[model samples]
Target: MKVGVVTFPGSLDDVDAQRAVRLGGHEAVALWHGDHNLQGVDAVVLPGGFSYGDYLRCGAISRFSPVMTEVVEAAGRGMPVLGICNGFQILCESHLLPGALVRNQRQKFLCLDQRLRIERTDTPWTAAYAEGQEVVIALKNGEGSFVADTETLDRLEGEGQVVARYLGENPNGSLRDIAGVSNERGNVVGLMPHPEHSVEELCGTGTDGLGFFALATLAAEVFA
Candidate 1:
């Protein structure tokens, strides 16, 4: 399996994301934000970062990158796309997933090994996880709060599109404790946690985050 990780002007986690893909037994392809092609990768990852110096707004400017044009088109065709942290913000800004990411309720940057419950495992990126399993992954962001209207929140909960939820306590005050969410088709997912950062065993943290990149083993069927 091949996973493409896009690098934007100010992307800081592209390297970690690529390493996670390689650690997951998949070919890691470096993709540029300005590129016009997707390099025929099986899946794509929008790594977390302060793209464009977090100008205008987090992920607001990066969403208009040339590569996003292809990404949006590919997602429309049901390709698996995973967005982490700032990438999640971009996904929301692009309207690929419903709702919006606002500043944390506490109005401060937070970094922690967050506990998340797997709400749904049918998505390609989460097939390795069991439903209701609690896994810890690195969570870091400022504008990580997930917000949506009452009706939209009900729809997400009713339809089971809420992919993951914070366990114990909400880190950034995300509405309904939503740590992650998927589109109606489940091919596109966006999460406020940084799963790529915890994939290395030598890093001291457990390798529980490897599930995000494990999609290579099952993504073929999902993409097909």
Candidate 2:
């Protein structure tokens, strides 16, 4: 399986995302934001980073990139797409997933090992997890609060689209502690945590984040 990680201007975690994909036993394809194609990747990952310097809202500008044009089309056609942190914001800005990420309620940047409860494991990026499992991953952001209207929230809950939720604390004041969500078909997933940073054993953080990359690769196999 080959996973493509996109690199936009100011993208800070593309290399780490690529590393995690390789560690998960897949070839990592480097993708540039200016490219007008996907380069035949089996799956795509939009890593955490300050795209376009977070101008006019975190992911607003990057959502219009040429790469996103391909990403959106591929995603609509059922290609699996995972968005992390600012990437999550990009997903929302692109309307690939419902809801929006706003500035943290505390109005400051936060960095911590966040505990997230697995809510749904059917999504392409979450198949490696079990229901109700609590996993810790690195989370850092200033505008990571997730919000949506009550009706959409209800729809997400009713449809089992909420993928993960904060276990101990709602770090950014996200509604119902939502840490991640998936689209209707479960092919697109967006989250505010960095799973790539916890895939190493010596890092002392458990390899909870590795499941995403592993599952993404496994999903590619299944699709193949």
Candidate 3:
């Protein structure tokens, strides 16, 4: 399987996401934010960073990038799309996922090894994880709090769209401690934590995050 890792201006973890893809036994394709083409990749990953300098808001400017046009279309076709950190914000801004990412309750940037419980394993990116399993990953962000209306939150929870939740203390004060979520089709996922940074034991928190990339390989076969 070939996974495209998009590199937007100010993307800090695009290369790390590419490395994770390779370590998961798949090819990684470099994608440019300014390109409207997807280059025929099987899946797409929007890595973490302060895109467009977080100008108006986190991910506000980058959501209008040329590459996101292709990404939104591909995701609509059931192509697996994973967004991390600032990428998560982009997904929300693009309306690919529900809710909005707001500033932390304490109004401060946070960096830590966050423990998240795998809530839904049916998504293409989470199939390798067991339900209720806990995994630690690197998390760093200022506006990571997930907010949604009560009805929407209830609908997401009722439909099993909530993918992961913070296990310990809520680092960013996300509503319901949501660390991740998936679209109705389960192909598009937005996660606040940096799973790419956790794929290598020597570098990040641990290798627990490798499951996300590993399971994505099967999505190509399933969707093909």
lDDT of 3 by residue, 45-78 (tens): 9999989988999899999999999999999999
All models, RMSD in angstroms:
1.5, 1.4, 1.3
Model 1: worst 10 consecutive residues (lDDT sum): 215-224
Q: Write the per-residue lDDT of candidate 1 for residues 111-160, one digit (tens) a residue.
A: 99899998989899898899998998989999999999999999999999
| Decoy 1 TM-score against native | 0.96
lDDT of 2 by residue, 13-113 (tens): 99999999998988999999999999999899999989999999999999999999999999999989999999999999999999999999999899999
lDDT score at residue 119, model 1, on the 0-100 scale: 92
What does the lDDT read for residue 204 in candidate 2?
A: 33
| Model 3 spans > 4 angstroms off | 216-224
Backbone clashes in model 2, listed as residue pairs:
none
Superposed model 1: Cα runs more than 4 Å off: 216-224
Candidate 3, run of 10 with poorest lDDT: 215-224
Better of 1 and 3 by lDDT: 3
